[model samples]
Target: MDGSSPAAAAVIERVLAFLDSKTVAACKTVNRTWYTLATIQSARNIDCHILQLSLRIAHYKRKGLLKSARSLTVDVSFVDGYLSPAAYERRVRDAAAMLQSSLMPVSHLKLHASSAHAALTDGEIHHGTTAIGLLTRALPSLASLDLSDCPAPLLTASRGECVASLGRLCRLKWLSLGSNDMSSATALRRMVRANVRTLVKLDGRGDVTDPTMQLLMDAPQLRQLDASGSGISDDCLLALVRKRGASLRELILSDCVRLTRHSIAQLTPKLLPQLASLDLYNVPVTTDAYQSLFNAQTHWPYLRDLKLKAAIHHASSRQESRATDDILESIGRNCPRLVSLRLFGCYGSTDSGLSAVLGNLGYLRELVVMHHPVDPLIDEEHSSSEAGGSQSGSSNTPTAAAPAANGPSSSLSSDADVWAGIPSLPSNGLPQHSSSARRAVLPLPSTAPSSPRPADAASGASSRQRIFTSGALRNGVRSQRFNLLNLDMTYDSECAAHLAKLSHLHTLCGRMITRHAKSLIEAQFPKCRMMVWNID
Candidate 1:
């Protein structure tokens, strides 16, 4: 309906709110009133690099842009289309200029200084600090600040300056100081103390200690806390939750050494009924705890992402495997809304258990399995005599850029079916990106003559060669890897058949998958990207 009348305008506005940015952008072409409304919606979250911001500002017009904008991300990584220490400083200056003059409506500001591809230098760090100072002071309406992606060294070095600059802002609703160690106790306390009132979501992974937890417990509005890889004890976590449990929605405690099954299990539904995500990487979870926490009757109704990577040293294969099985089994029955699940190094999950998980979680987008590098492709732990037969590295070595095809000594199978689920190789024989349109029948895995077993690893160390990892197809929502991962996992035909049935599935990664099953999955899902490993 046209916006001629007030009622019609209200209805149109309400409808626009439900639609996504692309849909909202398309609505602009309908009429003048739609264009004006759509423009505001489109500019609501302005996420761009320092280079792209000026262009976006020009398109939206400075005055309209300032009023319409709500979130601004000055990611300096994309400047000059490459990551260079020299160029980063200039982009930082450009960002500072923008934050100073413009961005009144913007409340959420993300200052991504450098990238993984770029090595951090003193120049970039200095400029990054300057940019942070300018934005915190300039943006009076600033409610959220995401410094998680910024280089850790920069954040750690300029702790005092950052705390001082951030204190200038009245309060922040969300603060992320994770991904790197900037968790000095004194500085963090001051920072958290300043933003305690409005702060709701806090990511202090690696830095949040028992003392910090004490301060966080005081924050009245705090709901989400990611204290993963921190030194917070079970008693502290239990105590903090008791104080802040009413509104706590997301709690990530991955790699928290002191936390045991008892403390985690003690987290009743009454404490965090609205808990949406729980990560316990390397933390051993008991059957009773999983059943209690994930049980529909007792606990979480909205839990979505559950990362329960069994503790390697603390967990035994047979025992932890059963725990993994129990958790996955309970998932379909208990946590149906679960779209992303991570179960790494759990010895118990067979093809049937995995198939059930895939089938049950209909809209399951991300599934991470066998992440812990428990067993390498070529076992280095054993000696030549212990291994029974150790192959000579020289005779069967693959190159750095592109590894050799499945040879007799190659870790994977030589059967054609093994490549079924993944995309077909191009005419040049290089692995291409996953595409449904160009479906070429792939050739069989080529084999080479078997190399004689070497006496010892040291004798063959110089002869060793590099293998390939699928960097192009890597889709890491959970980690910087594919969905299915097994360096030496037990995969078979039945599992492959059931997994292939998931037409929505995109990325597949793992090892020791049977040739026949791998082929079945590859053939069924022609668009799926894969990084499969050996059979035996």
Candidate 2:
């Protein structure tokens, strides 16, 4: 029962360890020492969901328990189980008051709120203005602020006075205002111009326009930018490329359908040199565009990841033959360092193109080629070759050829010989090392069973059935293999698994993977130290 006894010290140590394991709520029940440690840890990553938690955190500050805390997160979302809007607002104000008066200010603050429901509300104008006001006045020392899913009403209200308040945040380093409808790009430009010196990462997805982009391009410290779904044109992207080439690391123009090949060509030299990752998903880029991107000796030398979704077209006619081949060859040769490549829904790519990639990109770890025509080489034809080429007098051979027109038929002939080359891995049993080395090949889901067939097959009909079933088998096998790890069939699971396996993976799209997959990945890869998953 002695206060200084060894037993008392051991008990205190056990209680501290238990508190460390539990979250803020559970830790609160422990004694004073445990409470102190919990407060410190909780304040490191504050969840501004429950109003009472914020209130209690404020109380701790007043009592000087959280003097050593450095970071605070304020999330105002109903999904996170935050209080009702009115009550949440009051709590925010209370916390802001504490922050404003605290002896030690939080160095970093994150704000996440979904105003989609508010945007659709009847009295949105009032609600939006009030919410913006509360946020603008809160967390004065915030170094990073993420305003994703902010309501359109809030973004457009009062001529962007709220956003202009964002300019007043002199210490802000990162700002992400994705998925909001900012009606006036001019106001956003003003805000960007005002805060250009301190801002580093700018993500104005779907809301940014040319004028706002111009302002961001002029920003001094801006390094990472994501304007995906922002309706950004080639000209706007070019301006950014020309101005911010040296400092930039990542640029995502996904779903900007207006991005043409010519625009990409113009921006390539200026943007590709220092870029680590580029996303051109759903754009109208052609082979020439890719050629231009890698044409420069220094172009994307540091590039590690590239996403090309639905960018190319099939060589249906004679004119497209050279273009398609040129594009495929350029990707194979120039992007050897690419570790992660996603060619989702690209129609022009064939087995030749894929073979070029696999042969060159030896260090690839994650490759996604979903929705493209499945290569007979990787599907039924592969197994057929393994069983030995077609037997003599097999009925599979066509007896009569179609009458020729002007030249060789443009359609891909089934009789055309598939590539039989198999590249060897290095002595380490890994692909050659490259800065860009993640490879993923997601073909159209196989219709065949997952199991491999015997050496001999009886009929052509059986082979066709197996080919059709290949997609189903591939999906089923991958899902089953990773199911115990909680991985899904989507691109996210592939990405998460890749990261878990390759410890060096960065700039992953968390949306492609599920939360379950991420957890499993963390459990699997204890050595993976730095990872930032952008779920939204």
Most lDDT-accurate candidate: 1
Candidate 2 vs. truth: CA RMSD?
12.7
- Compose the digit string of candidate 2's lDDT tens values, residues 285-353: 655665666452534456677776443333433222122434654665676567666654433444345
Off by over 4 Å in 2: 1-39, 49-54, 62-65, 68-71, 75-94, 112-128, 159-164, 182-187, 269-271, 295-299, 311-333, 346-356, 359-362, 374-536
lDDT by residue (298-366, candidate 1, tens digit) is: 635687887775454422322432444455556755666776676655444443445455456654566
Top-TM-score candidate index: 1
Model 1: residues with Cα > 4 Å off, grouped in runs: 1-64, 75-103, 114-131, 151-161, 183-185, 284-299, 314-324, 349-365, 369-503, 508-524, 534-536
Least accurate 10 contiguous residues by lDDT in model 1: 439-448
lDDT of all the models against the reference?
0.59, 0.51
